[model samples]
Target chain A: MLNWIWIGLILAALLAAGVQDLGLVQLPGADAAVAEKGSRMAAVTEAAFDSAKTAVNIVIGLIGIMAMWLGLMRLADKAGLVQLLARALKPVLRRLFPDVPDGHPALGAMVMNIAANMLGLGNAATPLGLKAMEELDKLNPRKGTATNAMCTFLAINTAGFTLIPATVLGILAAAGSKTPHAIISTTLIASGVATITAIVTAKILERLPAFRLPPHDPPTADEPGAGKEATR
Target chain B: MRELLQAVATAVSSWAVPAMIGTILVAALVRRLPVYEEFVEGAKEGFQVGLRIIPFLVAMLVAMGMFRASGAIDVLKTIASPLLGAVGFPPDLLPMAIMRPLSGSGAQGLLAEIVKTFGPDSLLGRQAATMVGCSETTFYVLAVYFGSVAITRTRHAVVVGLTAELAGFITAIWVCRMVFA
Candidate 1:
């Protein structure tokens, strides 16, 4: 899926640049006037290079925040705080992922990931989410294919029900918004709706014939009855 | 109603981070966890995770930069504005909406630009900020998370993710217009 999007972006970029170079379309605004100095293609290439550099810088910037959150998370985990939190959310998690057995490590990991995400800890969320996915993969009957649980998990994560939206606030503050945090309630409401939609959509889609997992693939490990357990 | 909501938001924004940290520390203390050692271990893991994401970040960011700089987003904005305008979405926000699912940094840059051009107090700026807060970079998340697990076939994840992003976009516009207007 991303493969197609990546290719499409590159193709569309080249096509747009070609059109600009040919003077086939003159865009309105200062942006159009800037194209007079050089070819749009060259400019696009330069921007891509610049963004590549920026990407590295951004990652480096994330290290400190990521380390801080993950460190706190580790302390929480060792102290059984994660489990306590996970237990509190178990009923909801169980309903969302019936395929995952009760008390599964994946459930714990997923809970932690969601908690970290809600705090707007992007770096921490990714590792924890990856950890959750790895745990989910262990329960997959198919070696390469994604399971329903995995899809649902991804959907919810991508919905991004963040409470703080720290990055957006930081950007708005830097941009000199007198009320940088004014969007908090709106963000919560919007993302909350998106999260519900994502879960419901994933659930319904999995039931459709197109997305249903094939029956021939038998559960290879864990409980012999675990495969049947997932079917419910 | 709007004033009350804004006040609540202000309170949460101020206390959210500190509250989270406080909760974690209190939990650690109560549970008698080795706070300092555990932190070091997790921090190391976090550093490794940060390193792993670099390649994926570069790939996504470059694609985004190319898309934006090639004037493709402008073309999209021109084409999409009328259609989106009918639904009450500000045409100027089309680029950020389109880029939201593709790249986090790309969307953040667009959000900053919107705030700069419209002023952070402007309706468009507020809407863009809310949109940013609500949506995730679907493709980036998919790449890093799925890539980590070596999952090649994503199945319905992309569909569900994009659906969520669309929901966030529409809701952001609606909520912002109601609250900030």
Candidate 2:
């Protein structure tokens, strides 16, 4: 999965750079392409350095926002607000995630994450999402393998349901659009569809033979005679 | 109607953070909880989470950045134009949609470029903006969320995430056409 995609990106990048350098592929800027055939791979190496710096900077930027939200969330949890919210959403969330027990902290984190996302609050959403993941991980039967709940949660995050795409609107407004908000309903509709698609796909895929959990539960297996051993 | 919705959206976006924080702090105060101490403890953990994400972010972004700089997307654009044309989608907007799942900044840059090249009021610009609005940066989300938890075996998460992204892109194009075209 991630391993293949990571390696593929690196491999394809090197291959593309090589092809461009060899003049096998015509670049958009013909003059510059001809002048810098040898520099294609060098550009990739440069990008690696630049992106590493950018990555650190991105995290540094997140620290303030993450701290604020996590602090607020901590206060919410302490006030029992998180549990109240989780309980309110239990009926719906239970259907989406049957594995997570009622009133679980993960449910609260997820509810907050989705709420933040709906408000187009990226700064709040990521920390809350990661918090949700941490809570969900606590319930993992296997240490490294992703549980169905995790997959569903990730699916929802990737779908990114939103009421207003503030950043995109801001970009359009900055570009001098008189009607930058014209796409609001359209974005809402599209993201709604995408979110539904992601949940359904995750549910369907999780039930498939390839992705199903093994018949043997590890924790049970660890304790000899704790359960009836099935013959393989 | 649109203007009213926009106003409300703007107001919500502006006030959401303050309102949420205020409510939480107030609620904690009323409950007699040590809000300041709890916040500091949570903030400390937040700092740790940010630090932990550094390696994963570097790994994911470097690979994506190299791929972006390699001119691979241009090649993909050239290869994908015919298919896009068949569906009546603007080929020029392909780069933004493709980059949407990979990098947030890259997609933002592309959206800005498109808005600059094509008037923001134009159909292409509107479509690009909608696409950006709808689609999440799937790879970044996957890396950070899973990475924070140290979960390496992400079984169907990638597949599902990409499916969601593709669905968002297509729906963005279709909905844009229906509403703005």
Per-candidate DockQ vs. reference: 0.58, 0.76
Off by over 4 Å in 1: A30-37, A50-81, A173-178, A216-232, B1-58
TM-score of chain B of 2: 0.91
lDDT of 1 by residue, A1-232 (tens): 6668778988999998888778887778736535563788888888889989987897788778767766776776677766776677789988899998776767877987887788666656776787688679888867567899999999999999987788898999999989887888899999999999999999998888777777665546543443354431
lDDT for position B24 in model 2? 91
For every candidate, the chain B TM-score is: 0.70, 0.91
lDDT of 2 by residue, B30-72 (tens): 9999888999988888788888889989999999999988888
Query: Residue A178 in candidate 1 has what lDDT?
Result: 91
- The lowest-lDDT stretch of 10 consecutive residues in candidate 1 chain B is B5-14
| DockQ-based class of model 2 | medium
Measured over all alpha carbons after superposition, the RMSD of each candidate to the real structure, in angstroms, is 4.5, 3.3
Alpha-carbon shift of residue B67 in model 2 (angstroms): 0.5
Clash pairs, model 2 backbone: none
DockQ, candidate no. 2: 0.76
Task: Give the lDDT of residue A48 in candidate 1.
Answer: 87
